[model samples]
Target: MGFLMDLIGTLLRVNNLTYRYSSQDRNLLEKVSFTIGLKEKIGIVGPNGSGKSTLIKILVGELTDFEGNIEKPKCDLKIGYLPQDVSRDSDRILLEEVKAALPEVYKVEKNLRVLEKRLENDVDTEVLRDYGELLSKYETIEGFQLEEKIKKALSKLGFTKDDMKRNYNKLSGGEKTRVELAKILLEEPDLLILDEPTNHLDINSLEWLEEYLRRYKGTILVTSHDRYFLNKVVTSILELRDGKSTIYSGNYSFYIYERNLKEKQAWEKYEEQNRKIKKMEREAKRRKIWAKRKEKEKIGAKDKGFITHRAAKLAKRAKAVETRIKQMIEEEKVNKPAVEKQIRVKLETARHSGKIVLDVCELSKSFGDRILFNSLNFTIIRGKTIGIIGPNGSGKTTLIRILLGEIPADSGFIRWRTNIKIGYHAQEQENLNMENTILTEVKRENSDETFVRIVLGCLKFSQKRVYEKIKNISIGERVKVSLAKVLASQPDVLILDEPTNHLDVHVREALENALADYSGTIIVASHDRYLIKKLADEILEINGKETKYFPGSYSELKSKVEL
Candidate 1:
């Protein structure tokens, strides 16, 4: 009975939620409803502009103008929300920032110090009792081990001891995000909400986070585009589509399986309902025709009374059938299933080049005294896909820049074969002009406007959206535009840095299909394990001060390393 009561306790419940931007005509979320139980780990997933972030803000009480009844926990509920972008304006060092998360622990410690000073002069019984009680409370919250926890969290997030001493304001955006994540983990609120928490984490840090969240005692609600992270961290999936939310009782993989089955079932039900409705309509039409003929006979018959009675009976039966048909149409109407758009990218390559696409020997790069990589040697052959995997600041992007001659290498030799046309996709998307329209950007590669529009359409860009400025579009749309430009350029060698970063799962799969079908040499640096595993023929594992090449898929390499 106790277990059942606990199970019935709701952490958060939203009913008949309806929201819309004041400037927009239609609702962004219409009558959406769901309940999250205590200690449940739920993942929210959807395409860009599908209101995932907006819904999260609503749940966290940042926005309250919507029409709904949001039933929060009756007791004191501590909610820690980590937004997609974190402010990096703190003057404190990394360690100090994390330590500040536990203000209560410090307050208690300060009280203990004052009480000890009082005891040194006057040993009052009440004072002693207060001090003992405070001490017990501090111990219960593990205040004594605060430093240890801070250090462990920082280390797991790929921050070195030296990094802990560095000022938080001086760190990069990704570094600041990681520091904020560490602080959130240490805070450990009753409800932990993270938006794109895996954005800046590497494979190792991602693994650490997955493990940490698995053991977390509180309820967790996270929004992520990382398939592998979602699979590992979330116990259930909440998918938002067409302004509605659907809850699936399993992880991301299970959601995929169940969603496919559900879609198929929905389509079948729609078809079956259509067939039944058509049959009923036909029967109603036949009854109406029979009633009309009987009426005509009643008007023309010599024995008018008998013909009139029969006509009346036929008309009543037809009216009954008509009412039944109207009821069925009103109550049993079926809607067409939703269809997701697919991105189609084709990278047209130049004529055949030499067998060796790119060869690097004894490559080394550094910033001031910090070495990103040293003595790195790798070779890429034609028609091969090489995935570069590493922690952040490990020289993956630097190496790409060096090959493109955009930056000078400290010491290295990069040789590309003749007739090799390189198409580069920067991780920061610096190659794109933000002020340019999508059509304008694509026109830079190909002058034919009609062809460009067709290409954009294949990438799932509508005709109206093609004229919008790139800066006004979502990150995923920007990625698609960049991809379209790259594909239009017809490069023999493609160097992409984190290509799948802003893309949703469906579009990511579409890109995977496109790359798999490309007949050119491809070099990509990405944190998305699913993409890497599916598309990479070889793996370039870059650790600090060294680079190693593994011959096989990402999964094989992962298994070998795990062993």
Candidate 2:
């Protein structure tokens, strides 16, 4: 045992793991194997429906009944998991919610409730004594200072004193995530697992979480689509593709470099293997024909016995070889490169807009007495990309809506010149009809089925997948559907909000490339720094109180930001 620890010290190993849903026809994760080192920060990334979340659930024991062995480095290794959609009652107070997770406080509260119910039926010395004892137990657990302790935990996550009284449900999605993360961190577990942790966090909150995690003492396994976040926080990346695990020993940028090289090599091997397979198949067919001809000739031969015997032997050998080839083809077929796992989109514009796409002056918006932003002024040029960035609830979405005329700005002078058609992708996917099928959603009033299908096929939707309801598909698939509509429009201007929210890295890169190649004006509001860095030529930074504009790449804007 001592030697084992010395060789693979504090490693959590998963061996030959396989799992599937009860309703599925095949295994979602088949024979997947990987290991987590002590104090290692690893990011698990893959396209949607590739079993990243399934593997996480299996490791955290939320899913049992799988065929495999999970060997923990320590017998009592504690794991803390923060799942997707940790949002609960928004009406609950912050302090109460945090304290509810304490087992001791819950026990005392349970006992007090029992005593109170008993007293309602009949008062007795036993019930009174039990109630008083539970109260004393609560006091012993430092009940008076419990709120303060919870408050301290929340404060580090950027919560204020006034926020404690505010409704938890009313907070932005990013704030809700922070509140849930605080609960998980209070457990002080040895392994911290997070799923889609950056799905809602703003740029500021993302940086804070990345810094906090870099200084953490425990092992971290996070699944996220934010490439920049993964590059900044994790030392290694575990990619799940085709029901298998491949671990890269560096950050996301390194993984991309190595993965591209590996993919090129894999594709070369695959093409060569396919050629060999075709050759073998041709030889088998030729031999089968020769055996038949030999039999036909033997039927008219003088020495029929010997000829028949030779033909039978040759045919038997050929049949056995054919069976072997079939088995090889079925078992040894090489998987294609993962880079092929992306949507094919070409964003084209039919007409050219004027030099000025949008002109705005003295733009201001307020919801009740809370000012989201005021006196915001910015100009968008034709054929240029502008990225809108800000914290959650800081007027990023509101600004997009105001420009699209979906919502009204309190006071502003906005002018749109020389642009007729506009394609918009909303953050919440509200533009899509949830009840319709994916095929139906992408079909326009005048578009034919063939045209719509061709568009969906470009988005990687198979024939059967296109028929699935929009609500039944995964979030990534839905994003693709929305994108299919947006690209099909061929508008002069495009505006997207949180376009990369639920996309995997492959699709995100595809969207980025399509937008980069597009020769039209673009205004996108997103927290994906990588996308902004890749596509944006100008940056509009909103901070709830005012707006700051920088006419450069995202990296240049960051360099100009003061510490």
Candidate 3:
């Protein structure tokens, strides 16, 4: 009976949800609908600007003007939502910030303490009864273990003791996000909604979060571009594409398999319907030709009445076929599924370079008293791809800058092979000129304006978008523009720092493919495990004051090292 009830119970139901901006003619989300059951973990995925965030906002009651009917639980329910950008400010420490999520629990604790103090002095029966009631309530809610829960949640989210002691308002953006996530986890709401929760998390934190979500007792709805994380945490996939929602009854891998099968089936059905319609039209045309020939032959004939009757019958059949065609057009039209755009990237390489492309000897760098790397020695060979992995503040960007000669290393030398031109993609995309248009940015690398336009178009930039200033475009667009410039340079060595940070899955895959096919030496620092595993021939694991090189894929390196 419990199993049956759980299967039938719907925690949330959205009916015919439609939304559109006032300035637009088309709806951003058209007739989207889905349901979530109790404790179901759902992962939402879609391209950028595909209404994933809009749907999340609607679910959280932030957008009430949308055309939809949403049914929620009538009983006592709480909701916790983590938006893509967490900007909540507070002067309290991290522990206090997280504890604030459960104000009722804290309040109960305070009341219990006050009542106990009152009863110590005056043995009033009413006071004693109130204290007993408060104690029972506190125990029922497990309020005694609240502090322990908060500490555990924070530790699991990669927060150190020092972090908990620091003021929340003074933390960095990534730290703030982690603190906000810690608060949400501590809240333990009936429904937990997270948008891109894995954005700023390192590998360790991501693993911890995945495990935590697995054991979470709430219904989870998360939208993330991290495919590996989605596969680990979610039991089902909710794909938002072309203003619609598709629920796949399995994890990320299963969704990919099922989506391919579904698209194939839809295409086949459309083709079959089109064939039938075409055949019907051909038969109708034959009947009309036969009627016209018969009518002409029946003119002034002895059996003119019979011939005319047969001709009229043929004409009537043709008219009926035309009506049927119209009905089919109106009732049986099959819309072809939308295809996502893919970025095309080609990294040009030099014809020949020395066997050793780059060599770093006794490299050391320090900021103030903290040393990022010390005596870091590594060598890169031609036609090799190396992945750099480490924690957030482990100097991946600093190392890349030293290699490019943009920053001076405190002690050591970087030697590059002769005639080896280098292409660099900065993590923050600072290499791009914000004042310049996308077209102008690409034109700087290559003087051919026509080629530049084609390259921009291939990177999924529309003609109108190509003329927009880099500052006005999105981070993803700016990344593409920077990438176009790098590709145009045709360097013998390519160095990228967190290149996959803002790219969607499709574009990331495109980049991976382009790099895999390139003959040049590639070095990239990224937290994207899928990309690292797919491209890296060796792993450069960077820890504080140490660098280790393992000649294998990221998965292999994970087994060998303590990531």
**Which is the leading candidate under lDDT?**
1
Query: Across residues 1-563, which tens digit of lDDT does each residue of candidate 3 receive?
Result: 01113544778899999999888889999999899988899999887888988899999988888997999866655788999887778988888788778888878987887888888899999999888888889888888798888888888777778887999889988888888898888877888999899999887788889999999877899998888898899999988887888899989989989988998898898888889889999999999999999999988799999999999999999999989989988998887656645555555684569899888899999999989988888888999999998877788889888888889999989899987888898877877888999998888988878767756666667788888998898988788888878766677988988888888766676667767767899999988888888899999888675778787888887786565
Which of the predicted structures, 1 or 2, would earn the higher lDDT when compared with the native?
Answer: 1
Candidate 1 lDDT trough over 10 residues, lowest sum: 1-10
lDDT of 1: 0.85
The C-alpha stretches of model 1 lying farther than 4 A from their native spots are 1-8, 109-141, 271-331, 341-347, 448-451
Q: Candidates' TM-scores?
A: 0.85, 0.78, 0.85
Which candidate, 1 or 3, has the higher lDDT? 1
lDDT by residue (tens digit), candidate 1, 1-563: 01113544788898989899998888999898999888899999987777899999999888999998899865677888889888759898888788887888878977998999999999999999999999999999798899889999999999998888999899988888888898888888878899999988998899899999998888899999999989988999999888998999999999999999998898898899888878877877787788788878877679988877877777788788778877877987788788665555555686778889889898888899978878778888899999999987788888788889989888879999976788888766767899999999989988878767766876667878888999999888888889878766767988999998888876776677778867898999998998899889999988785678888999999899889
